[model samples]
Target: MLPWLLCALLGVLVLALLGKVCALTRSMEEICDQLADRLAGDTNNLLTLSTRDPHARRLAARLNVQLRLLRQQRRRYLNGDRELKEAVTNLSHDLRTPLTALCGYLDLLDRQETSPAVARYLDQIRSRAEAMKALTEEIFRYSLLAARESWDWEDVTLNQVLEESLLAHYGALTQRGITPQLDLTEVPVHRRLDRKAVSRVLANLLSNALKYSAGDLRVALTPAGEITFSNTAPGLTPVMVGRLFDRFYTVETGRTATGLGLAIAKLLTEAMGGTIQADYRGETLTLTLRFPPAEEKAAPRAVPGGGGVE
Candidate 1:
């Protein structure tokens, strides 16, 4: 009877040890899950566990302290960023009023006749004023874009928009003695994107091409909804190509451009759940954009019946 009693006590101790270990394991999993949720979401919840394990409780307490510190830093960063963008927008807007007045005076001067030398000097001043005006306007546009909070997403007919953007720039391309080559897909490709944002993105890219293309431009849209804009840029390096989408980045020849074109495109494209990339290959520069397809199909929006380099 004594031996049987000792065996029963030992069995009970073993079972209790197993139960404690299982409880600890569960507590660790709970802490892990809560920690992940806290990181991904903006919430005030802390790690909560079922068991009263001293070690796990201490671990959760330490993590909660760290999370509080992290949240504080994140808040500070966001506030600073928001304030910077607002300041830029305000400054750019203020400069526009004076710039407009300066340009008005310059135009008035252009009308008055003078000697060839005086006229030549006036022309140089006028050109500088115009360039400043352009830079100011581009800065304004970029600042506005940077401070934008959201865009309305909808089903957009991808091919039609591309055609319209190309046609819009037709006159400019022709004036530069270059014809844009377009190979848009016949099949109607649709995507879920912000229409106005998409238009702005394409406009910026085409403008970039106009500013930098050696002598030709080619635009193509695949059936799968990939859009590519390719041109021969005579002196672009791999490093320049890599930073093409960076904010306020421009090449020596592209001084007239504010360098915000592709940056804004990238910002809006990624915001709309799209991808934009630039590649420089053997003197040719190519920009590609891919937008996710819509879950629900919609009819193509009406567009003018002409496409093919306008």
Candidate 2:
């Protein structure tokens, strides 16, 4: 009888140990799920395990320490980002007033009649002043746009916007002696986009082409919402092409390159749930932009009538 009782007590002890381990395993799984949820969402709560198992408790303690540190670092980064944005906004505002006054004076000077030498000097002054004014405006606009988290959206027909932008730069293109080859789809390619933002993006691309094109400029729009702007850019290196959309990055070959054009285009494109990319190959640089069709809109079924202008 004694031997039987001892054997029964040993079995009971083993079962208790197994139960404890299973409890620990379940507790650990719960802790992992809670941690994953905290990471995915905005929660930063510390992990707490109900099990008194040493291993489970230790893991929970370690995770809680790391979580607290991560939250602190994230908070610090957000604060710094906000501060920098505010500074840029203030600086843009400060520069605009003086820039306006300077442009006013330059206009006044341009109106005054003078000798040929004086006239030449005034013209140079006017050109430089105009460039400065343009740069100032772009900077101010960039700061404002960067600070904005959302955009005012609308239904924008890209073909019409493209035509308008091209026409606006027609004089510049003509002066440069470059006839743009345009292949536009006849069927209206409609997108739910910010008209002003898309217009600015097109204008920037056209302006960049005017500055860099070595005789050839090609622009095409497809029914799939893809827009391509291709031009011969002999001056750009592979490295430069890679950083084409980086903010305030200018290269020696680009005259009057503020480096903000592509950056602004990228910012606005991303904000509108679109993408813009640059490709460089054998003296040619191509910029491609696309906007994903809106979810609620049906796929466009209109037949495409494509045309090209030399």
Candidate 3:
């Protein structure tokens, strides 16, 4: 009887040891599975241990907090990288125009002659220089707008703005022998906008149209106070249309275009709660400009006699 009792006690001790070993094995397997899952995860690879496991749960919570912070940092880094790339692209495009012009002017000046050809070359140089100046100014203006700053708005007349822009480009239009087709109806078209900014937008659009148009420049104002500028051109592709408002995107013309004109215009327009769009079909390019209607007190002035030149 004494021997049987000792054997029974030994058996009980062995069973208790086996239960502890089984529990340890199960815990180890769980930990290994969690580690594998975390390793396989693409992002935020913090393991989530069961709440019953106090030590593992605490570790997982700490890891999760760190992972979230890492994700936020990574997003910021990527965003900054993308913006830097865009800025570089814009800078390259802007620089290319002036560089091309400078080269052409230098080549012409190198020639030994005092003839009409030399005069033409000088004229080309002057034109290119002016274009470069305009491009620089436009870039500066866009930078100001992109700084996320606000401007004071006042009531401005749409017709007056259009007229001023037209007057500014009158000389160039006359030189090109393109008639100004003004289709303005008798209406009071006013909107709350920054006058100087809106003027720049219109000027940029008209300048681009005059530069590219082969013939027939039409400037039409609708009764609803919307403005439309259309010109005869070789038309634009779908790709060009899509990128019309993108910075440093120009048409496929071999001519020296800084490609920032339309981009600046678009930015200023949006800043003023207005919209601008392009419609191209065959050999025609039309730009539609829309804004809030003007106050009744701000009516358009009568068209001047002889269409006063700039």
TM-scores for all candidates? Answer: 0.85, 0.75, 0.56
Quantify all predictions' global Cα lDDT against the true fold. 0.83, 0.81, 0.71
Question: What's model 3's overall lDDT?
Answer: 0.71
Local error of candidate 2 at 256, Å? 1.7
Worst lDDT 10-window in candidate 2: 301-310
Name every residue pair that clashes in candidate 3.
190-294
lDDT of 2 by residue, 106-185 (tens): 77877888899998987887778777767777777777776655455678898899999999999999999989999999
Q: Highest TM-score, which number? A: 1
The digit string of per-residue lDDT tens for model 3 on 249-300 reads 7887625677878887877776566678988888688889887554433332
Q: What is candidate 1's lDDT per residue for 1-310, written digit by digit as tens?
A: 9999999999999999999899989998998888999997778887888888899899999999999999999888778877876787788889889989998988898789889999999888878878787878877777666665555667789999998998898999999988988898899998877788889899999999999899999999998888999999988999999999998889988867777789878877766667899999999999999875754333222111110110
Give lDDT: candidate 3, residue 180: 84
Among the numbered candidates, top lDDT falls to 1
- The lowest-lDDT stretch of 10 consecutive residues in candidate 3 is 301-310
Candidate with more favorable, higher TM-score: 1 or 3: 1
TM-score-based ranking: 1, 2, 3
TM-score of 1: 0.85
Over 4 Å off in model 1, which ranges? 1-21, 113-115, 294-310
